[model samples]
Target: MIWIAIRMLTGDRQKYYGLIFGIAFSTLLITQQLTIFVNLVERGASGTYNVPNADVWVMDGVSRTTDVNYPMPSTALDRVRSVPGVEWAVPHLRASASVRSGDGDLEGVSIIGVDDATLIGLPRNMVEGSADVLSQPDSVIIDDVGVTRLFEDGRSPIGERLELNDQRAVIRGIADAVPGFTSQVTLYTKYSQALRYVPGTRNRLSFVLVGAADNVSADELARRIHEQTGLRARTRDQFARDGIEFIVRNTGIPLNFGITVGLGFIVGVAIVGLTFSLFIRDNIKQFGALKAIGVTNAKIRAMVSAQAGLVGFTGYGLGVIGTMLFIWGFSANPFFKGFYIPWQIPLVSLAAVMLILALTGWLALRNVLKTEPASVFR
Candidate 1:
């Protein structure tokens, strides 16, 4: 009986191909849009996540995110270090500055200053040079993405001189850092070097990154710091969430992506419902003939289910393959770098496909079930 149903579905190449394309296209749309959305919002937390050694981040009470922060007094670092649970606290500076490339092109760039002695905030990996290169006089490390933007000729950015805040910044190395949401060029330097690169104000410290002592929980240390210092304190995960929330509250990305995903759902339902209904209606005579031969409705249902299952699996597999190819192809492009399809997204898409098939299949089956066995003669 199942073989007969499979034959019936495959016999109509036009409708079968149409159904597969519809489901595949819909799945592609939903999965692709969601992937891009997730990666874009996550860029907000890239700064926090890049510094793997810091268990807690101390900032001004009003600071909302890593980029949108208020510079605290320099003494703020000392206050944080005074906390008992803090094993060590280092000052971190993040500020924006304009840079002049070799061709006199002006670009806005982010300046990140890590701990001088330990280089605690530097990225774990280096693309071209060692992290110790920042220790050189007037030295800085440009992010790999920034190297592409600043030096487009594929020449080595090493030893290239950039003008920042009327100071000479020599790119001594290339750091493999994640690009921020705006894709701004980022430069990493020692704390003192960054102060020189960025036009300084009285308060130079933007944040204090802390390491918790042995046996001390990050959450507990953060709590104690907040209580004693009267400054905002957040565990690493909490601060990352703050960054994401900042983007969500300020941007329209979520709404736009939500609409795109909803449209994918609608398209899938419309195409699948129409094609499935027509296919079932055209086979109504066949269904009646089987009923007349003593085949039960339960058997008929199993037949329809088998047909739906075949179409669903085939379409879903093609869609996922398409998505993987899309991500892999664009991985080299800076904007799409580090973008990945989260496992949960595929599961969600699968549930959507199942719901679409079940609803359309049930509606199409109603007409076949109501037809009397005598209808085979009509």
Candidate 2:
């Protein structure tokens, strides 16, 4: 039956060839776009600014991890220490402000401040400078990309002493991390520097980052801290999941943005279906001849299904190759610095596309089976 179906479809080379390529092209586009969108959302949520994998985190009264809009009073550190299973809690301040490059005018910067006591939250793998460089008063750290984006490769603005508010500061180091996947280049400074830059704020810290005792469970500790302080304390794992879910649900990503990609897939299926139907419709006489030879309706139906599957399957395979190339090339390009392609997404998404292709072939098969061989005799 499969061989018969293949022979029937290939009998008309001109008709199904264009349909084959069109379906393949559609698959390539939809798969690549969906892969990018999902990868971006996933990376953004837990990439950097991501909590270190540990027992628990101590933040302000806010329940959501990304909603660090309010300051976690510097005094929050002391209270976190008293909680059992807390090995240590690091304190830091984070906010955004404008930068004066001394080039022309001030630009925007997302300033993050951390203490020497616990810079664990950072990516820790130094691309340029040491984490401890931030220990010096008014000393700052910038990523290589950040420096280039902000001051044209640290030529003019970096290293030079500048005024951040009333306080004098110097760019001491360059670093990189995954925090805020698409966040602008930032200025990293000490807790004191952050205090000075963000004025009209309490001298207290914003949040306490707690590392739990190794022997004990983090969940128990998170529960304790949450109960005690009326503040939210989440483990690093929870934080990452919450972060991804937040972007997916609140940002209308999986529902709205993803639907467009889904439509692309449906269109691919339709194109393949129409192409098969066109050939079947055009060859009513051939089908009639097969029927006249005592071919069962079920066999004819299977033949139709096998033909659609053959074309769809061939197109789907080619689409996977093309989509992979696009994913790799686009992510590596300089223009897509903020965008990232995680390793897991492509493998999973490819599998999904294959399954969808099979389903699409099944759908188009129904139309093929409905063609009556007797129509050709009339």
Candidate 3:
């Protein structure tokens, strides 16, 4: 019976192909937009992820995210270090500054100050030069993304000099760091050097990166620090989630991507509904003949389900493949770096495809079910 239903569906080349195209387009649209949306929002947490060594991040009470933090007093570092569960604490500074490139082009950049002695806050990966280069006079490491922005002419930024806050700065290394939500250029220097590059304020310590003692968990250590110092302390994972939530709350990105995904489902319904209705109308006589031969309406329902299943499966596979190819082709672009399709995204798309098929199939089946056994003779 299922084989017969499959044959009936594929027998009509035009409508059959139309149904597949509808499902594939919907799946592709939803999956691709969702993949891009997820990646963009996850960029908010890139700052925390870049500094992998930090088990806990201690900051001012009102500071919500890494990018939106208020500077804390330098004494906050010592206070956090005093916490029982803290193994070590390092002063971390993040501030915005304007830089004059070698070509005299002025660009706004984020200045990150890693610990001078241990260099604990710098990104672990270096693209071009070693992290040891920061030991040189006035040397700073540019992030990989910043290299593309600051040196757009394909020139090497390795020896490029910049004037940051009227202070001479040299780029000696390229750090393989994730670009922030704003995709701003980032330069990493020693904490002391960064103090000179960025305009000074009464409180210049943006955060304290803390390593938890082996005997304590990060969450426990964070709790102890917060209780002891009256400061906001978040475990690494918690802080990362905070950054992601901040973007969702502040930006219209969620609504925008959500609307696109909704439209894809609607489009799938429209296209598949029209095509499936036409298919059932043309096959009404066949359905009536089957009914006349003692084939029940229950059997007819199963047939229709089988047909929808085939279309949904084939279309869903094609859509996923198309999305994969799209991501692969653009992987080399700096903007799409580290973009990945989450596993859950494909399953979400598959459920959408099934819902589209089920809804359209049910509507299209109504006419077939109502067909009288005598109608075949008419």
Candidate 4:
């Protein structure tokens, strides 16, 4: 029966392929778009997630009290270091200045200052340059994606120098694809090198990055800091969560994707329903012949179900392949953060789509069964 179903669908492209193509493309677009959208929210949160070991982040009191970038008292950093479970503490200075390069002016760079030892929470997976580059008084590290500002031809070479804030600094090394939340073309510099661009201060940092031992909870560390010094602290994990919430709840991302996924769902049902109904009309003669050949109505219904399952499973496999190819292509683009399909999301989507297709087939099956075998003989 299965072999017959396969041969029938393979031979009847005029009847089946149109339906298959329509269903497959809808699935592919919805899956890829939704998958990329979710990943963007997660990737946007990455800078906050990188320092998983940090139990707390101490913020300076300025702007909104919740603003993470405002500078706190430098002495507050020492207070965090002395906390019982605290292993080490460092300050992170975030400054933004227009960086002048021979190529042009680049804006919204995240200039980070870290203590010589702790390095203000640099991610371990920096692709280019050594961690020691921050130790240099004027040296700075920039991600390869942002290196385009330094040279017209992006992949020019290593050690090409650029002028920032009218100050001379050497490119220590290149990191990969770390972007600022607001700007796409962004760069990074040393904490002290960044100070050269700040409005007034030359030595002070913006905020502090604190590290804690395995024994500490981020919440506990946060409380200890407030109790001792009355400063605000944050954890990397909490930052990731807040960042995602900020983008989705505070921005248009969630609303936009929600509309897209909703449309996809509606189109999916429409495609399956219309195509299967037409198929039932075309194959009515076949169903009638089986009923006349000593086949019970239940047996004929079973055959119709087998055929729908075959079409649905085949279309789904093709859709997933097409979606994966789309993902690979988008991952390489500089503006895109690559596509990631998590286990739970795609799994649930697949189940929902299949169930929808099944319901569509069942409706067509009802109409198909009612076509009297006697009418075909007449």
Candidate 5:
């Protein structure tokens, strides 16, 4: 009996193909859009996450996100380090400055100053030279993304020189750091080097990246720092969340992507509902004939379920595959760098496909069940 239903469902190549296309297109739309949305918003936190050694970040009370932070007094670092349960603390500086490229082009760049002694806040991975190269006189490390932007002609930036804040800086290394929201050129230099590269300010310390002592939780350490120093302290995860929330609250990205996803759901329902209904209605006589034989309504329902299952599986599989291919193809592009399809998104899309099939299948089955066995004679 199940075999007969499978044959019937597949026999109508037109409706079968239509149903698959509907599900596939909807899944592709929802999955791909959501993936891009998530990666894009998360870019705001890339700076925080790139430094994996820091367990806590202490900044000015008014500082919200990494990019929008206000520099704290240099004493703030000492205060944070003095707190109990604080293992170690280092001063971090993030400031923007205009740089004169080798070709005399003026470009805005972000200057990140890591600890001069420990180099604690530098990115863990290096694409070119070792992190130690920062010790070279007037040396700075450019992020991989910045390399492409600063030297668009595919020239090696290792020995390139740039004038920053009227100070000459030589690129000595390439750090494999994630690009921030603005995709600005990022130059990593020692705390002392950054001081010269950026215009002098009374308070040049943007943040104090801290590591919690053994047996000390990051949350607890942050709380202690906040209470003792009267500074805003956030755990690494908490700060990352703040970055994402900042983007969500300030931008229309969430609303825009949400609309696209919602439209995908609606399109799935409309197309699958209409096609499934028509397919069932056209096969009503066949269903009536089976009922005339010894097949009960329960058996008929199972048959319809099998048909929906096949369509759902095939369509969902194809849709997910398509989405994977899209992401993989663009992986080399700077815009899509680090873009990945989270496991949960596919499951979410699967649930949506099932819901679409269930609703449409239920509506289509009602007519078949009510038809009399003699209706086949008409």
Candidate 6:
């Protein structure tokens, strides 16, 4: 029965192809937009992710995210270090500075200052040169994303000189760091060097990166630091979530992507519904003939379901493949770097595809179910 139904569906190649295309197009749009959206929002946590070693982030009470932070007095580091569960605490500086590139064009860049002795705040991996290069005089490391922005002509930024706040900064290395939410160019230097590069303020410390003692969990350490110092202390994961939430609350990205996903659902329903209805209308006599034979309405329902299942499976697979190809093709683009479709996104798309098939199939089935056995004589 299912085989016969599939053959009937395939008999009309135009409608058959149209149905599949509709499902596939909708799946691709929904999945692709969702993948990009997730990746973009996740960039809000990139600063925290780049500094892989920190267990706790101690900052001023008013500071919300790594980027949207209020500077704290240098003594804040001492207060966090005094906390019992803290094994080590270092001063971390994150500030924005305008730099005069080698070409004399002024560009805004984020300055990250890692511990001078431990380099704990630098990214775990370096794309070029060694982390030890920061030991060189007037040295700073540029992130890989920054490399493309600062040197657009495919020229190497290594040894490139920039003027920041009347101080010379030599690009000594390239850090394999995640791009920030704004895809801002980031330069990492020793804490002391960053202090000189960025315009001086009364409170120079932006955050105190802390390592919890082996016996203490990050959460416990965070609570202890917060209780003792009356400062904002967040575990690494909590701080990352904070950054992500801040972006979601502040930006229109969620609403924009949501509207796009809704449109995909609507488009799928429109195309698939119209084509399926036409298919059922043209094949009315066949359905009536089957009813006249031993085939019951229950059997007829199964046949239609089999057809819908086939279309949904084929279309869903093709759409997901198309999305994967799109991501792979643009992987080299700085903006699309590190983009990945989460596991749950595909599951959500699958549910959407099934809903589309069920809705359209149910509507198209009404006429077939109501057909009288004698209607075939007409």
lDDT of 6 at 350: 100
Alpha-carbon lDDT, every model: 0.93, 0.66, 0.94, 0.65, 0.93, 0.95
Candidate 6 residue pairs in clash (backbone atoms < 3 Å): none
* Candidate 4: tens digits of C-alpha lDDT, residues 274-377: 87788778777877876777677777667767777777677777877887777778766555543567766666567756776778878888876787888779
Task: Show pairs that collide, candidate 1.
Answer: none
Total colliding residue pairs, candidate 2? 6
The digit string of per-residue lDDT tens for model 1 on 244-293 reads 88888899999999999999999999999999999999899999999999
TM-score of each: 0.98, 0.84, 0.98, 0.87, 0.97, 0.99
Query: Whole-model lDDT for model 2 versus the true structure?
Result: 0.66
lDDT of 2 by residue, 15-50 (tens): 668667856776677666776676657654543244
Query: lDDT of candidate 4?
Result: 0.65
Query: In order, what is each prediction's RMSD in angstroms?
Result: 1.0, 3.4, 0.9, 3.0, 1.3, 0.6
Counting clashing residue pairs in each candidate, in order, gives 0, 6, 0, 6, 0, 0
Indicate the TM-score of model 5.
Answer: 0.97
Please write out the lDDT profile of model 5 over residues 243-264, one tens digit for every residue. 9999999999999999999999
lDDT (0-100) at residue 183 of candidate 2?
Answer: 47
lDDT tens digits by residue: candidate 3, 181-227: 98899999999999998877799999999999899999999999988
Q: What lDDT score goes with residue 29 in model 5?
A: 95
* Model 3 ranges off by over 4 Å: none
RMSD of candidate 6 to the truth, in angstroms, is 0.6
